[model samples]
Target: MNRAINCHVGCRCSHLTIEVSHGSYRNFTQRFVKAVVNTYKDLIEWPKNEHRVAEIKNGFMYGEGRNAWGLPAVGALDGKNFVIESETVHAEDWRDCKGNFSMKLMAVCDDKSKFTYISAGNSGRSHDAAAFNLSEIATVAMENHGEYFPLDGYILADSAYPLSHYIIVPYPASEVLGRSGGASAKKKFNKIHSSTRKAVERAFGILVSGRRFVSKHIYIKDTGDIVGIIIAYYILHNLCIEMNDPVLEEDNDETSNVDVARPDSFIQSVNSTAYQNGRIRRHSINPYFPSQQ
Candidate 1:
């Protein structure tokens, strides 16, 4: 953890270099890794929610959300890339059909846009909902003592997450997922209500837009360690988010200059079925407000 903190603050520590360097894992050997990981994980102290909330509120507003629980919380949950070092043999198949198959890391940030929970350890082949099913937030509440979040607290998520009684789905099925109702106006009303629930996307977007969550230069070979690194980066990213640190953002217009997503190949064109389905899916997302939820 000290290594992570030091590396983040420009200490240029050896841990960061060794972490990504070739054959570094071999240096520690597998047994050493397990001991080190257990030691570091045990020592890790994720900051409290109140401290994070205070820092985040100083920089940004909930945008469209209310001060629920008296915190300017920004709802967060994201599907992000977890770059790997290349796999040796089966790398080709693990590669995303569009490109490389980085592990997918999902997380839930709070109203201040700080990470309250992060769920890791998913293969890139998994869909967003598959990961959501194994969410830490859902299971952790039952195991840990005391109520972690306010009893009146709730969350909003995209359709990719399972609709639960605790967290609300902001967009109705059709508007969010392009799955229309079976001839009910009630569905449309639900859709209207859900449109405002998009603060999560914006929160996620800001994280990814900055290099802290996504390194501009990524090349992976699927190291077993990369998964933790990816997750650690997400946790670190949210720390930066909570800090509201000024980071150099990528210019999407100049995305060409940065490392392109490492798919073995680009998605050349929309398949006939995809083209049809994609249009329908996109049509459902806020035709009225491109920037709105």
Candidate 2:
């Protein structure tokens, strides 16, 4: 096999047995990715059926060979940044907080680390919450929560996302510590949330570490191409999961844990009715998890 093509497919090719031009390789990869994405896009859809929903919920509760968190969640939500070449139109918009020119990929994954929902091509500068709020899933979730998140179930998200009827966020660490000054019900809940939410992070790790095209800085100038390539890899990731491919050891350690900065205030405060409802729901479940010493 050609060395460049072999390496591009995530197999370590040590020797250059055949020379392949960069342009030719890139064009080939683009065509290959487009074909894969178009043929298998349905593999990365949100769970809608009762059986699938129950399976995802069970996966979350007993994931990583651990006990159930007892929370009704179908998926874990998170965002990731994919580095890209800086020479593009509106390049400044892609500059993230860490000074990398990249694009944001928001996703929700099941307990088995398979991507169930994905929204790519957002500016890296956009907050995770903002990116999610603009996603089709969020729009549909807001319009009819039961249609997506049935039986009052919600997605488990980190603090970067806002709490809503369809999404549940962990209690802010600062607020949790300040309220009790030590271990408490909220603190225990955060621990469980983090444990369960790590599934989404692991899903991203599998994508980045398994695909050489995604792990390296993409040199594409067009944002559309970049988005397509990323989404194609996500589709491939789901296919790999379906095949029960063994996850690489390094993938577990490749999880990204960037801290998000929150906004000072909201323009429409009344919209917080949902936030308050989320808080109430969280509090209602707090008693179920007794704090331990």
Candidate 3:
């Protein structure tokens, strides 16, 4: 492969052709990368053990006083934008809130900076909350309801996400950005929320910093191809952590759930009751917290 790439670099073709020896270097590189990614994408599985969920919940609770924000959380949710160089049929949909042309990669990572859930391929224009709602993880969480979440445990996210029983978000801007003497109570909560959510940023930093391809502008035109590449990056990211791959630096040692069953109507009723209970529980923790309504 190295020899073929070297040959391609030596030869000057007016137009790069896939018919070259083993195809052009760019073509071969894309196929080889995607092939490896597809083969190992299964490695990026979400932990389903209740015990592991408990461990994560416990870890967050113990760390709350210092960094976790007092929320019994199993993961921190956030999103990253990736630039796509190829023009698409719906080019306008690729524009993000920041006015940049890109795609969104939404993910949930644990305290250790390992991703527990990821949903990518959303157009850049899609809001973080909207992208999350459409993710498979969200669908699973909704379907399983009480069975999925650990007791009193929820995921922590920024204000960009809607607050629910299973997910906690920061106080609203009105409370967090209040006048000098107004609603000072929410300040502490917001501080904790921001502090805990910083883990997601660190995770993205480690991911993009470690993977050169993700750091560079992605030129793939096909949405599926882009998703595969991102997933491939994630698989390698986790494997490196598991095997302690040395290509990553010491500091970068990086590298970086559930079931339920019930009758249709009965399950829906149970889910509603669970949601109400969760709301009450949240209120008990913070009476000033805003209601989802």
lDDT by residue for model 1 (234-257), tens: 555555654668744443432212
- Write down the lDDT that model 3 would get: 0.63
- Indicate the worst ten consecutive residues by lDDT in candidate 3: 253-262
Ranked candidates (TM-score, high to low): 2, 3, 1
Write one digit per residue (lDDT tens) for candidate 3, span 1-293: 33333343433341344445434555766787688766766666555568878777666556644633345577888887887754557687788776777888988877666778788888888877678878875778756756666564677776565556777665455544555533554566556656666666767777777765666466556677677678777777877766866533323322210111122343224346654554455455562345421
Model 2 lDDT, full chain set: 0.74
> Judged by lDDT, which candidate is best?
2
Q: What are the candidates' C-alpha RMSDs?
A: 11.1, 4.2, 8.7
> How large an RMSD does model 3 have?
8.7
Cα-based lDDT for every prediction: 0.45, 0.74, 0.63
Candidate ordering by lDDT (highest first) = 2, 3, 1
TM-score-better candidate, 2 vs 3: 2
Better of 1 and 2 by TM-score: 2
Residue-wise C-alpha lDDT for candidate 2, range 181-252, written one tens digit per residue: 434677777777777888888777767676666675775677888888788888988998899888764475
Error of 2 at 264 (Å): 9.1
